[model samples]
Target chain A: MSGREEILGRVREALSVPSHAGVKAVSGEGVRDVRKARGFLPDGGATPEARLKKFRKLAAKLKAEVEVLPDLAAAGAFLADLAKTEGWRQIASHRNDLTNSVLTSLKVPILWTDDEPGTADLEQVEAGVTSCEALIAQTGSVFVTGKGCGGRALSVLPPHHVVIATLDQLLPDMLAAFDLLRERYGDNPPSFVSFITGASRTGDIERILVLGAHGPKRLTILIVGN
Target chain B: MTSDTPAHQFQEDSAVSTADFEHRQWMQDALHGYENTRGGTEAMFGDFEQARQTAAAIKWEAIENLDTLLGEFADKLEARGTRVFWAGNGKEAVDYILGVCKEHGAKNIIKSKCMTTEEIHLNPALEAAGMQVVESDLGEYIVQLREEPPFHFVFPAMHLKRDRISQIFEEKLGTEPSSDPEELTMIARRVMRQKYCEADIGISGANFAVADSGMISITENEGNARLTTSLPKVHIAVLGIEKVVPKLEDLSVMLQMLGTAGTGQWLTAYNSMIGGPRQPGEVDGPEEFHVVLLDNHRTKLLADPEQRDALRCIRCGACLNVCPIFKNIGGHNYGTTYQGPIGSVITPHLRGLQSYKHLSFSSSLCGACSETCPVKIDLHHHLMRNRRNAVQEKGGKMERWMFGQFAKVMTHPKRYRGSEGLMRFGAKLWLPFKGRKLDPLKAWTASRDLPAPAPKSFMKQWQAQEREQEEGKS
Candidate 1:
């Protein structure tokens, strides 16, 4: 017998349950009910304003910069000023409409990572900016799917990452974020989904916090008020 | 490294580790830091007890229907173009990986930190096949350089000083010696970044496998797992069969509990869920994705109803951090891929009771491990059961005989009084050789001073006081 067959058989015998039990048990439930069953809301009040405030506070604690801009134009201006201050010559970004507008306003040399740039090209870019699927307030996490981020390397390879998102993307907690994902994607989800809480970090060496370990060292979030 | 049996080796290994002053100090400092921050992070969960119960229920339901859940997971993954392989043991798992490597003509492999791989002993086999394998996690990298097993579960190089790490980097990588941790992290990062780009195969272990979505969730503080998966053309994830969860939504509870309980983080820096190979429009990620579900004695563990709860572990390493015995002896003393309370309960079942029964006896029967467990597995009770089973199997003749004698004397007052007289006489005879090595007292007084026995029994003293009161009243 194949290893798969043997393993499944052993599992069935060990648990003393027949095959296809789980499928039978879960057929009646809808995704909404499943979401409600394990709905875990963070301690902060569940409102857009409250979530945004909590997100800013938690993001700051994680050493990430957060700016709540008035509009897309203000976000663009903020990015432009940030680029000048941080001395970034070129910024890599995806082909999203919002990302395009911000990059166009900055007037800096742009590397379109949507075209799948090489590792050497990605290394040369000082920073990368992209829009996210959702921003979790409780943990200060940005949810990025493979389709939304163009590719994983754009967010990981650059030394600095600047995310441009609107207030509508904020969720109360991880459960709400997963609910949003299920509502949007249905059964056919993206190949890769990541909940990036902060810039890359490690405390492996004598338990000392060090940032920028094989990923971005600095993360700046531009939250445009919708 | 010792020729002694596992039972004897455990005593010797623990003795050596317990006496190492520097190692003990390092463990104390690390555990204190963990204790200070863990409570605050766990408090962020808001109704953490409810969350724990929810997590436990999800795991229990999934394990009860593991056959169906695993089948659903495999089907969904295969439908998404992921190849699923099931291995009954470590050899089968290793053969499948080597076969894949040979098929692709791969020369170099990079791996993220995974305890399952360590359980299977995968590295030496890959190196024996003439492939250059590198461990991407900084902690794992340090221990890899030293050719030693991880000193702790989460903190692989927890026993080493910063200067020792600097020296290892200088000798191995020919880099400048620096004691700064930030510089040390960057040095390892600089070296590993090139390896990520150059490697042909990338491997990882899943923190959780979502059955409904057929996705593998990997949580890490470093971005190495992310880089390891995205850079290579072929990505392989080796997971234990018990890592499965029934629904994708259940991930929220497990992830929250895991982050807080493991490293005292509200959430880890990165939590990645990979469903299959890169989609058509995606520019990065592996071209081929493989998921190997390994049983490796897990089915045997599941068959016993009393011990099946051991499979609910999320590999958070919290129990190890809070365990008093683990703090004293350190991680490497366990002489296994897994260490501490959870390791003690499950290792005997995974490996066998005969070889690993001593691990069950090594504990102080402290319930600290169970109290700290996010899933509430009744770990201390499981250790007691192991002891019961071990004695039942091995038949401890000497212990039984001694306990029988004590029970006989305690049950009868006449014999008990007779023994009290004998003990008073024996105490005087053995008082001179208290510090010397002797049969019964040797083990007790090896490092301690035994208190002298009372001159008279407690019962006799009570009777004397009663007689004095009666005479005074008359």
Candidate 2:
């Protein structure tokens, strides 16, 4: 048997045992019901209007405290302007085409590198920008597959993360979004796919939401219009 | 409060603040573990309620039908040319893991953070068999250095402060004192880098095992888990039977949910899916791979419809991060391998109800854990069920008697009203000595003020209000 066949055959045999009782075949669509099966309502309220209202309310409540940009271009400009204003020393982006494109367009003076971000560079770099695979419109989430986007650390470690996502990347719901992902790539997909809604925020100590506890503090989403 | 005082004996270990080097050192270590785990967990759960439901449902689906999927998984694993071992309990699991280590002549073994191994206490057994086991995960490494059990699942060193870590590293490895987190991380990486290279075997926990390809998936940011499995000659994974999913497509939904719920991320830095070792043209990976499927009270848990959903936990740590009780007291306060809402519910199931009788009541039942769980385990309700089971069925004789008496009085209003005056008489007699040496109220009086009893209870006031309303109408 071929290598793929051999591996898949093992998976089939392992799945064949009487012990694998819960091993029901669920399609990409069934995965949506799995999320609903858990009885999870999206972050805001149930209705789309309510969810939108809640998102807006939450954004407004935290807007003054947590930074929000109008769009991806404005976000990029804000980050660029912030870099200049703050005298940021370095900038980093994943080796993906879109991020490289953004870096080319922005044409900032900061030393831009598209290599794997290490701890030392992450500390020195003032900003990190990357193109995202998917964005959840409801909660302002951004998804990045690890292969092209310099993996998880590039977005997580840097203090300021500016994600450039296209309009078509936006998903109406998380269940629908995940379904789309599975439909595109089967079980053995990429090594990593990250969904980042906002910057690293923690309320662990006395329930006071502290940004940059372990990951990036400021996350600016740049929704690139098609 | 009574139990809290013992925890305060290690008061210096609390990770709430960096106040003084002595106390703050402990707090930083604790906070480090808390932050590490919470960061990862929140990233995975994204939204607590959504993640919790998804996790709970997925887990229930996995376990309720375990008999079929596990068999399929076993078959798939064997077809991949990997060895599969079914361990009925902790002893069997430990025996199989140690046996694998011994068979490989594994003098050194590097491990990622696998709680099931901890549940089975595999390390000591491996050690007893004369093999050195090194935890490659940074947080687990710190806890190993401190000679303490893991406080948090994801971030094991959460209970230790940075200064304490500096002191440990300084003592063990002759490193200098530094409280900076980056410096601490570098220090750990520098040490673990060596351990990873020389180890003969790699051991890890599976986040999800894809039945489609017999692939064991592990999610991590540090890349240590990858190194542990990939670089070693022999790789062994210790997983609960419930970790298996039927296909790779199913694994995607889990990865997305696990990523968000565990650390509030869309995905982790490393979502490694390895099927049995290196193939024909592979450059690197283990030569031999074995997965020890541990039952260890899981079958019993699976039998119960109410408790079976707890198995769906991706171990994302989101529930622990959002749990108010866990935040204040930390994971050790629960006194089990699992901690927080899920821990409070699962510990008794795995260890049985006798030793961990007090673990269930530790939660305030605020449902924060349930609200935050990525798989939606209904943690709060399960916690309540654990408490009810404890009182009605488990041995809480005194508690049951007190509640039974209280219930009797509550149900019979006449008897309750008649006893109210007598209760007041006792209160009046006890008041003069309050806050003094002669005070009967020791614990309550020392911590907070006991409000003076109302002259008339709400029931009496309500009755008077009703009479006034009737008079006015007439």
Candidate 3:
């Protein structure tokens, strides 16, 4: 059966099951009742356009926050310049062509032959740049599939992270992205699919969004257009 | 920080008021966190409808032919020299895992974030058996330190304020007072790193188990997961039966969605595909590898097609983040391993409908969970169905009578019409004695003012309008 059919059938069966008989059962099933009680109602209005409007507004707000680079080469240049300005001697890049070429062009001494940044002399490197498999324009997020980009440390260890992505890789929303992901990776996608919105940010310290927590502080995105 | 503290008391409370209050707080915090994550996630789901359609088709096709595919997958995994154990439920699953730990003499066990383990309450079981289990994932580790269950599925510690974390780190790890997130993560990393290396056995939950090559896939941003599986001498992977897909190609498709949807990452840093024990040419891998295929209520979930969509969940916290109820109460207030919309539906199934019957009432019938689900699980619908089931199958005598009276009053126009006058009379009568508030309506009045009942019902007013129109026309 199709997914919709399968799901619909289950819903029908669930509805056919009995509801509580009286007040005590309702009170006894308090939290659970509230949860289950809040399902779709026939009288409930249709999906609201205001919700979509809010989503659009939020997306626009995020786009404003993230600096969108024009192309891959431009992004590479930006990263190369960032390293140059910082006066860093050593750097790390994943073994992918775009990453390797960018690093080579910059003429920085490369460490950690493997793609993972953790293996590199993290203390020595000022920045790390890797190619992203997907770029989320909605939140200015970039994903680094572990397959091509080495390991988690590449983004985590470096003080600064420069992620490179083509605009074609951008997905509209989480739902749409999953569909594409399934198409490419199937049931067993890569071991890790990092959904990075901005720099490694965490508010766990002081209820403040402290960027550069166990990961990069300065996240530079290079959005390559089609 | 003290045992006698309000925080401690709150945690210990079994009362509904305290639980509701705490649950509300959790939901708010989670919603904010979700807001932060959603921005980046949306960008990754560029053509969301197309992606979902494709994913649903792939998943449906796979499930339809799951039997044959599972057989093929079993053959391949066995060929790779990994022992696969099929457990019927939480008890059996935990037993099989503990058995592995015992066979290997594993004293120290390090684990990545696995909801299945949480569903089974495996840590207490392992510790009871005299084994030490450490959560290696950053969020899991933080929650473990707090001695709290996950508040959010993807970001288990999302409900925790940074101050709480700083306090926990100071108390548990004796860290310096640094509320900086970076500094805090460094502390967690330094602590978990040691656990990862010292671990005798490693356990993880698979995002997907590829039947074609018999490969178990683990996706994560933290290196701890990879370290846990790779550094340990023996590796044990516990996964749900519904996690299986027929081929590597199909597995890839699901991962695409899971990776982006779960955390808004295009892909996580590590996607480790383990094929049994270390092969001839492999440099680093576990000496022994075992796979436990957990069936716990999944076959039953599959039997009922609608509920099976719950199985399609990739443990993404998107729904929880968007859920107003989850934001308010937090994960712990639910008093179950799973939290939020998905948790409400799944908990009743996993633990039995009787124990967690109240969980269904925690929601406001919001369809946010359905909108956010990566696999399109109709969490809202299931929640409603759960309510119906509770009333029909598990309701008490008082509940049945009250609802029956309500149904009768609602169905009868004359009785309903007369009830309006009674409400007004009652309101006026109680107003004098209410002393600025009605005692019976205290809960309702606390958050909102009670509207006075109308003199006439809407149905009655509509009938009057029809009569007036007919007379005017004549």
Candidate 4:
């Protein structure tokens, strides 16, 4: 017998579950609806202003720099200032629409990668910039999909990562983030989706907190008010 | 690796572990740090009990429908171009991975932190097949360099001091000796960065497998898992069949519970949900994705209704952190890949009751483990059940005889009163030699002094008080 058949047979025998047991197929909408009705997700903040406040506070606590800007132009200006202060000669960025618009106004040298970035290209770059899919307020996590900057490499390979997001993308919690994902992607989701809480960190060595382990050391989120 | 000989070795292992004062001191400090951070986690989730209960229900629903859910997950993953392999045991799983390596002519491999791989001893097998395997997790790498098993679940090298780690790095990697953890971490990062880019195959263990989307979610504080999957030409995920949830929505609750219960974080630094290989437009990811579903002895645990809840473990190590015996004895004493309360309950069934039954009796039965369990598994009760089953299977001749005599005397009031006097007389005779090795009381007296019995039995004192009360009334 095939290993799959044998294993499945064993599972049925072990659980004493009938072979014809009717397992309900859960749809994306059904999951969202049920989770919404359950109300188990913790409340981040009641108002958008309250959420923004909580987001900024929690993001800072995780050691991520949070700057709330009035518009994309303001965000561009902040990035330009940050680049000058950090002495970044070139920044690796995804060639997405939002990133293009933001970089067009900034005078920083932008290195755009439309394909898989070579290790040399990623290692040489000082910073990476990407537009996030959503921002979770409760955990201060920025949700990025495979379609974001350089797929997964740009967000992790560089020493510095800057996420440019609009205020409207902020959600109360992970559950709401999933709800928005289902609403946007339907059945065909990206190959990779990451919820980056902070810059790369490791407490593996005697539980000492050290940043910049394989991923960006500094995570800066520039939130533009809609 | 097997529990057959562990019952006899447990005493020696525990003695060695406890005798190391330096290790014990390090463990105490680490435990304190974990508890302090855990307090912050509890505050982050205001109603942790409600969250735990909801998480438990989700696990229960998923496990009950394991057959259907696993089938659906396999089908969906196959549809997404991920080759799903079902392995009946660890050997089968290892052989299949080796076969894949040969097919691709892969030589070097990089692996993330995976307890399942440790449980199956996967690395040595791969190495024996002429492959160089590098462990990327900082703690795992330290233990790997020392040629030792993980001392703790989450903190693999919790027993080692920073100075010792410095020595290991100096010896193994020929780096300058440094006691600073940050410097040590940077040294490892420098070494492992090349391995990730050079590896032919990357392997990982799934934290949760969303059956609805056929995606594997891996949570880690470091980005090693992300690099392990993204850089390799072929990515293989070895998962125990039990690590499946029914839907993606369930992940929201599971991740919350796991983050708090495991490392006391609101969310780990990275939570990646990976599906198949690179998609049509994706620029980076594995060209080939393979999922190995392992069912080594898990089916046996699933068959038993009384102990099946043991499979509900997400391996958060919360129980180990809270266990008093584990704190004193340490994880290596358990002599199993999985250790502490959950290990004691499942080791007998996974390895065999005859050899591992002693672990069930090793606990203090304080019920702290059950209370701290995120899934609300009745862990202590399961240990008790193992003890009962062990005794029923093979009655202990001395224990049965002694308990039988006590039962006879306790049922008869006159015999009990007579024995009470005899016990007082016996204690007076035996108390002098209690400190001697040959004395029967040697085990009990070695660590503590025996408390002196009351001058008079409670029954006689109670009767005398009643008589005095009656005389005073008259």
Candidate 5:
């Protein structure tokens, strides 16, 4: 028999034996609904304004730079100013509805992710700017997918991750985020989905927090709304 | 002092680590920060205890129905062009992984931090086959350089200070020594960047496998796992069969619970899920994806309804951190891929009862591990059960005979009174040896003093008092 069959056979054999001690199992024997998590999980607030407030507080606590601009034009101006201040010569981004319009007039060399840019090219770029699926308010996470966010490497390879998300994209918690993903993608979800909470960090050395361990050091979220 | 015999090694390493007060201080200080953060994070939950119940219920649901979930999980991966392999044991897992590397003609491979891979001891096998393997996690890389297993699960090099890390970096990579944590991290980051770009295959361990969606989820504070999955042309995820969850939505609770328990964070910086290789519309990812489902004695664990709850562990390392025995003897002393309460309970089942049973005794029976368990695993009681099972399987003739002898002596009133003198005489003999190994009760007397047998039997004093009272009344 194949290894799969043999292993499954063993599993079947194992579960077949009755408990000698008559130990009881969980209340529901199979497929416990994850939706039962509503009571105990950390709340993400009921109102959008409340969620945004929580997001801003958490994002700041995690040391990610969050800016709520009035409009996309303002967001672009803010990002362009950030680029000039940080002395960015080259930028990496994908041509999506949000990022394309945001990067249109920004003066910098561009490494478009849609072009299948080389690793060396992405590495040399100052920052990776991609649009996200949603922003998680409770955990202050930015949700991205391989198909939606210029593949996986764009958000990961560059030293600075710049996410330009609209205010309407903010979701209350991970539960809602997962629901949105299911409703949108159905059975065929993106091969890679991530909940990027903050700038990449590690406390490996003497319990000291060090950002940009392998991915972006600075995570800048530009939440644009009129 | 490390020995081929695991039981002896446990003793030798415990003696060595406990004596190093300076090193123990480092471990204590590191865990202190973890305690504060974990306490603060737990308070943020609306009902942390209720959440644990939900977490436990979900895990129970998963493990009890293992065959169906594992089959469904595998089917989901295969449907998306991911070749799924079932490995019965460590050798099979190693063989399949090496075979994949050969098929892909892989030269350099980058690996994320994973205990399952550690359990199988994969790196040595890969190196022996002339493949270069690099550990991408900062803590893991430091331990790899020092040629040591991780000091702790979550913080792999938790026992080391920055000075030691810089020394290793300087010697191994010929980089200048710097005491700054950021500088040390930057050095590793620079080195790993090249490794990620050049590697042909990326191997990872999953925190959970979503059976409903057919995806493997990985959680990490650093993005090294991210690059490992994203950059390489071939990606292989090796995980135990028990990692399955019924659906993707389950991670909504699992991830947060794991984060609060493991490192006391709201969530680790990266919680990524991969269901397939690069999809048709995707621009860049590994062309081929492989998921290796390793049973390696887990099915043996699942079959026992009494101990099956131990399989619900999410590898958060919370139990180890809070365990007093683990705090003292340390991770290396356990001499297993996993350490502390969960390790003690499950190692015997995974390896064997007779040989590894000593681990079950290396606990204070404090139940702190059980109290703190996010999934509410009854860890301390499980340890006691391991001990019971060991004694049952391999009958302890000497211990059984001695207990029988004591039972006989206590039952007869004449013998019980006469044994008082015998016990006092026996104490005199045992007093001289004190804590020496020759003393049969050295385990009790090693660090404490047993008071000299009370000067007079309490029975004689009580009899005298009763006679005096009767004479005065008359």
Candidate 6:
């Protein structure tokens, strides 16, 4: 018999003896109700201000550069000032409402993701600037998708990663982020859905923290809000 | 030495490791740092113990209905144009991966950290097939360059100091010695930049397989996995059959707990879910995506309900961090793909009871493993239970025989009195040889003095007391 048949047969035989101590499993669709279990997870705050405050707090702890600007105009000014200080020659980004509004302020050469940019060229750029789907407050994570956030590699390949997001994009926690994903693209989801938490890091050598192992070393999130 | 058994190998290696105070201190210091950070991070949870219960229940649900969830996971993956292969053992899994490499005429392969691949010894097989495999994770890469298996499952090169790591790089890569972690990381990052672009296939291991969403989730502190999957034309994920969870949203509960428990972070740097090859409109990803489901004695573990909960292991290394035995003996001494308390409990079932039962017996039965386990496997009890199972299976004959003799002497009054006298005589005679080479209690007495046995038996003393009382009454 094939591996599938033999393995399934073995599993069926093994599970015949009922041993679960009354852990009720939702039959049919087989997706157990997780709403109750989510309560056990760290609670994101109830109000928007509390969530925003929590996001900044976590971002600071992770050593990520989080700038909460009053509006997009102020964000653009901040980016322009950052561009000058970092001495950036070019920025890699994909065209979107967020990117379109902010690109003019950088006043630097742009490497567009949609233009079929070479991988080597993408590597040499100063930073990859993209718009994220949501900013998760509970873990201080940015949710990105292949189709939405300039494909899979753009946000990760460059040395520095800059995420431009609006206040409305901030979600309370991971569950809300997952719910937003299901609502946006349920059946035919994007090929890659990622939660980018803080900068790329490693503690592999004598358990010492080293930033920018293979991905971006610096992750700057600009949240434009009131 | 003539025995040449794994049990003997474990003993010899353990002796070497435990005596090396420098090595033991390194392990203890690393774990001490882990404990302090993990304590605070765990407190960030709304209810840490409650979170553990929920994680355990979800894993329990996943394992109990393994067949259905696995089928659903496969069906959904296949629906999205991903090829699915089932391998009953490690050899089959390796064969399937080799066939994929051959079909693509692959040259260089880039791999992220995957303990499942290590479990199957995938790299050696691939290299023997003439494919160059480069480990991308910093620790795995360091250990790979040193031509050794990972020292710890998570911290693959945890045993090596920075100077030692620099020495390895100098010997292998003709690079200058540098002790700074940032410089060493840059050295690897610089070297692998071209390999990711040139590699034909990328192999990864999934932390959880979401059956409902047809996606496999990978958690990593570094972005090696992200680059591995994104750049390569063919992405293959090999996961154990027991990794299946019911829904994608279940990650909402599992991911944060995994990050905190595994590395003492609120969350790891990147958590990615890949459902299939790149879609029609998507800009980049692998052209072909393959998912290999490996059973490899997991069904044997599942068949025994008493030990079945062990399959819920998330490979978080939390149990290892808390285990006193692991800290003392270290990882390589266990001689298994996994090490520490979890390895001891499950190795007997995964490998064989008679051969690996020594691992189970080596533990101090402190129950620290059970308490530290996030998925809540009864680890210490399982270790004890493995002892019973090993004996019942006609193993541990020497122990059983000795106990049988003990039971016989205790049952008869004459034999008890006679043996008691003999023991006292023996104790007196044994005093000179206590810590000598000829001593039976030499191993115990070598470190410290053993309390001397009483000069007279309890029965004789009691009889004398009764005689004196009778005289007093008269």
Interface RMSD list for the candidates:
4.8, 8.8, 11.8, 4.8, 1.7, 2.9
Which digits, one per residue and each the tens of the lDDT, describe model 2 over residues A1-226?
1322433334344334343322222223344345443233334245644544443443343221223345555655756676678677677775556665556546454433343233444546777677766755444455565444554346654567777766556565555555665677654334445455555443322223444534455666655552
Q: Which window of ten consecutive residues has the lowest lDDT sum in model 5 chain B? A: B1-10
Tens digit per residue, CA lDDT, model 3, A89-191 = 8877667676765556676787653622333255358777678776543333455655555554465556677776665666543334445656776644443
Residues B1-474 of candidate 1: C-alpha lDDT, one tens digit per residue: 463887778888887888888878879889889977888886776666666666666777778878999999999999999999999999999999999998999999999999999999999999999999999999999999999999887889888889999999999999999989999999998999889888999999999999999999999988999989888899999999999999988888788788888998878999999999988787777899999999999999888777787788898998999998999899887888889999999999999998998888888987999888877777888899899999898967999999999999999999999988898889889888887756368867877777877887788899999999999999
- Which candidate, 3 or 5, would have the higher TM-score against the true structure? 5
Q: Please, what are the lDDT tens digits per residue for candidate 6 over residues B1-474? A: 533988999988887788899989988999999999999998888888777777887898899889999989999999999999999999999999999999999999999999999999999999999999999999999999999998889889999999999998899888999989889988999888988989999999999999999999999988999999999899999999989888888899889889988888989999999999999878778999999999999999898867788888899999899999999998998899999999998888889999999998898999988888877888998899899998888755787789899999999998888887788788889988888899999768866788776877777799999999999999
Query: Cα lDDT of all candidates, in order?
Result: 0.86, 0.63, 0.63, 0.84, 0.90, 0.89
Q: How high is each candidate's TM-score?
A: 0.95, 0.66, 0.68, 0.93, 0.96, 0.95
Docking class of 5: medium
TM-score of chain B of each: 0.97, 0.85, 0.86, 0.94, 0.95, 0.95
Error of 6 at B34 (Å): 0.5
The best candidate by DockQ is 5
DockQ for each numbered candidate: 0.47, 0.06, 0.07, 0.45, 0.74, 0.60
Q: Quick one: ranking by TM-score, best first?
A: 5, 1, 6, 4, 3, 2
Candidate 5 lDDT score at position B67: 90
**What lDDT tens digits, residue by residue, belong to model 4 across residues A68-104?**
8898788888888887899988888888777877888
Query: First chain TM-score in every candidate?
Result: 0.87, 0.66, 0.65, 0.86, 0.94, 0.91
lDDT of 1 at A193: 93
Total clashing pairs for each candidate: 0, 82, 96, 0, 0, 0
lDDT of 4: 0.84
Which is the better candidate, 2 or 5, if ranked by TM-score? 5
Which residue ranges in model 5 land beyond 4 Å of their true spot? Answer: A19-32, B1-4, B430-446, B462-474
Residue B403 error for model 3, in Å?
A: 4.2
Q: After superposing candidate 6, which stretches have Cα over 4 Å from the reference?
A: A20-33, B411-415, B440-451, B457-474
The DockQ ranking, best first, is 5, 6, 1, 4, 3, 2
